[model samples]
Target: MTQKAKSRQEIAEEFGISAKTLSRWILKEKLQIPQGLISPKDQELIYEKFGKAISK
Candidate 1:
């Protein structure tokens, strides 16, 4: 499956987190956001970490 790249706003909404928090995660290296934009691999990793919480 080809996953689409998502913007910071999209990721924040899908993860149920604030964009500011997402940005902080990126800055802190808690989340590995790729240079320029968020890639599919990055999205998958983020989902693997937070998907369950957001799904509930």
Candidate 2:
């Protein structure tokens, strides 16, 4: 038996944030939180689109 990968909501819960907030960060490329929480691919995608983080 093997465990399935967690969903976005599950990931957000682990980080103590809401799924919507997580989506916002990912979609808008605003990663203002701590490191090691986000995947490298996501980081690269965000950086590629937004250049840098623009916190709100």
Query: Which runs in model 1 stand beyond 4 Å of their true positions?
Result: 26-29, 52-56
lDDT of 1: 0.69
Q: How close is candidate 1 to the true structure, as a TM-score?
A: 0.63
**lDDT by residue for model 1 over 1-56, one digit each (tens)?**
22687677777876688888878766776765766668878777766765633432
> How well does candidate 1 score on lDDT at residue 56?
25
Q: What TM-score, computed on C-alpha atoms, does each candidate reach?
A: 0.63, 0.44
lDDT for residue 31 in candidate 1, whole number 0-100: 69
Q: What is the lDDT of candidate 2?
A: 0.53
The 10-residue segment of model 1 with minimum total lDDT is 47-56
TM-score of 2: 0.44
Off by over 4 Å in 2: 1-4, 30-56
lDDT of 1 at 7: 79
